[model samples]
Target: MEILSKEKNARNCKFKTRHGEIETPFFMPVATKASVKHLSSIELETIGTPAIISNSLVLYLRPGLEVIEKFKGLHNFMKFHNVIFTDSGGFQMLRPAFLIDYNEQGINFKSPFDGKKFNFTPEKSMEVQEKIGADVVMCLDNLPEYGQDYESVKDAVKLTHAWADRCIKAHKDKKQLLFGITQGSVFPALRKKSIEFFNKKEVDGLALGGLCIGESKKKMFDSIKLHAKYLRKDKVRYLMGVGSPPDIVNSVNEGIDIFDSVFPTQNARHGNLFTSKGKLHILRKEFFKDESPIDENCSCYVCKNYSRAYIQYQLKFKEGVGYKLATYHNIHYITNLMKEIRLNIKENNFKKFRKEFLSNWVTKE
Candidate 1:
């Protein structure tokens, strides 16, 4: 709600949300099924996470409306009282081969658990979100796979915009915020058009979808820069599915306010740990005798209490605590990084911070 500071190199700005003030250039941990993988809500809060993302599609299918209705909504149901955002389930519905059937009217998708066919329209998405009760909800947009032709891309954009309109109309709670997602795969003109369309729609927030699916990093960054030019600076601008440390910092410098991805949790499960310097693979033979903490600078419980050698040994033996420790460290690393970025911005030295961080980070290999 307030602009704390602006970055000189990018359109990044720090703003406050109702639940808590989130520093711009921050990443939202992916909690697709109302929980981040292998971590509880209390653990997430302890790790200093600003927010988490839940999938509207997954919750709608597995728990159905009955479970959420009992609890009054996702926030109370999950017991995560902080800021929460819900993706319209558009992406997940189409990704798996057998999960969905695409049509102009709307998507007719099968529930992965029961194989019962379910239909999700833009209006229905809004209804589901309203019942689920998240602080931020996304419009149900058509997300096309990579390698689609121009006409298909164009049609998807048009449908996305149309659905955004329906979503806004169907939204009953004025207190809840709706964000429109821009969908145009690798086409700048289409991307530009989609941004212009949503800008006029006047949604509370904007997200650039359809990236990081299969596009090159070059294309992804270029598209973000171009879209940021047209997006409203006052409202939050979230770049969906981006959560790597480098990607987060770069996207933040490109004016992205929020992001979510499963990379940290997924990679942590495989023994990868994020640090201020860069990523470290803990399963390697070299760490067998190493006695240092995961990251020397990190003050996380995992870093303070354990060593890389102990984690490697635990992971080698397939211990559940190993996964928990790695996840805690990685999430803590990212959360702390964003905190530092905010401090740098308030001190008017974000450019210096970015340069020094990236220099040490990219040279780790």
Candidate 2:
């Protein structure tokens, strides 16, 4: 990876992973269960998605290792050629566990799919990701929800740092890159400590976890501003599980290089369309007679060939195609937004671009 340019706190960079090279600051569409809900890998590729994030937990539990090993790696299993990052399954800790416990041994939780119980140690996470085969593999980190006290946050950070060391020691795949996750909730002091600890580790990248998990936008951005500067500049900086338009713009300005979230695809499945001017509710009555595209400036196939009324009709009738089309358009919109962001950074006009975008992109309370 190389930083090509910088303007204020923002950076224009490029990363060459084992799978392929991608330009940063990029957005990764979430493929939680090895599929992006209503779309295929080919559809995602067609929409210009440079990469994607999938859950290692699902793959480990459902098909087991035998099925994936038959295909060698997730790329072969999913038939996706672009870059892929696998979550270490640490986020599962946030769920309501039928039986849960956390110790120095790691996370023990019941599988929601089956009644079987399993423990996911940092070593185990590394092993699963190695079998699942992603270009970038994440370390197992203790991620607590928002509003945790300082002591709890401090303990989470301690566990995260300990687990990161174990993951580093256990990861043996030379082709796969291991990334350490920083978890300190919104405590600036703890976050700074987490950053400093990982900066000295032998990990290939660093990811900001534990944000946007019910914290206010102000708190999240404040943490980003506080910790991003301390992150190793040469390593790829990923802000995990955040994909709102305004948040993406602000995070990029704070020097975050990669991001993944279910926002666009999930909202699109519910008849929401992300547009240049603002988010549009496709099911609204105002669009029933309107023949315009979702976004006049959108060049996605859905917008180019279909009218807003057509999509609304499909969505109103609950047609499967409606969800697919909407998902496609939303993914295209976000990826294109990333492209525009990179272009603006290259042109040294990122500040202007972000200000103008937010001014027009009205956010409803």
Candidate 3:
């Protein structure tokens, strides 16, 4: 990972993994359970996704390591040539209404896939991530609920920092890079302390977790401002689970270099589509006879070949093609936006680009 230059907080950088080299300020599409929902690997590649992130815990529980090991790693297993990052699944440990439990030792939870029970410790997270063998891996960090009390949030940060240390010790793969995670809910002081703690570690990168979990936009952006600067400038900085256009702009301005989220694809599945002008719901009555493409500015296959009326019809009728097309266009939209962001940063016009983009991009209603 290397930063080539900076325009204020926005960066033009290069990230080289075992699989390939990519520029920073890139977006990673989420492929939870080892596949991007409804989109094939070739389709993902065609849309120009530079990298992707997957769930380490889910893969370990579902397919098991033996399956991935047979193909040599996640890249070969999934047939993707680009970089892949696998999250440690510490976040998943916090879910499950009553079956989840965690202490300093580790987390104990029942697999949602098979009703089987399993324990996930810091060492175990590393073991699973290493076997999955993605270009980048994340440390297992405790994530408190979004609206937790200050004391709970403080304790979660302490546990996360402690787990980061253990993860560093257990991570032995030379080919894969391990990233330390910082958790502090929305408390600025705790966020600062968490960032500083990770700065002292020797991990390959740093990730900001526990945001966008139900917090207001103001709080989430404020938290980013409070801690993003404290991160080590020499390594990559990732904001986990954030992918809205406005949020991505804010994070990049705060110096975050990489991102991953299910928002675009997830929303696409439900007929919510993103466009250069604003968000669009294809199933709306306004598009009943609209023959226009999903986005006139977009050149993706879906936009190039289909119209709003057709996609709306497919979605309204519960046809599989609607989901696939929306997924394709949405991914293309965000990835294209990232490409434009990188260019603007290089040209020293990122501030202007962000301002113009957001001024015209309507996200709500």
How accurate locally, in lDDT, is each candidate?
A: 0.84, 0.89, 0.88
Q: List the candidates' TM-scores in order.
A: 0.96, 0.97, 0.97
Candidate 3, 4-65: lDDT as tens digits = 87999888799778887889899999998888988888999988899999999888877889
Misplaced by over 4 Å in model 3 are none
TM-score, candidate 1, is: 0.96
The candidate, 1 or 2, that scores higher on TM-score is 2
- Stretches off by above 4 angstroms in model 2 are none
What's model 3's overall lDDT?
Answer: 0.88
Across 1-365, the per-residue lDDT of candidate 2 in tens digits comes to: 78998999898888778877789999999987889989999999898899999999888998888899999989999989999999977777556763388888898888888879898888888999999889999999988767889998899899999999999999998778888899889888899999999999998888999988899889999989876778888898999989988899999999998999999988898788999988888888888988999898999999999999899998888899999989999999999999999999999999999999989897432
All models, RMSD in angstroms: 1.6, 1.3, 1.2
Across 1-365, the per-residue lDDT of candidate 1 in tens digits comes to 44667875454465545566566667789998899988899999888787899988889886877999899899889989788998889887777843567776678888767788888888898999888888889999988898899999999999888888888889888778888999889999999999989888858888999999888999999899998788767777889988888888888787777888988888888888887778888988888999999989889999999999999998889899998899888888888888887788778887888889888784232
Candidate number that wins on lDDT, 1 or 2: 2
Q: Residue 8 in candidate 1 has what lDDT?
A: 59
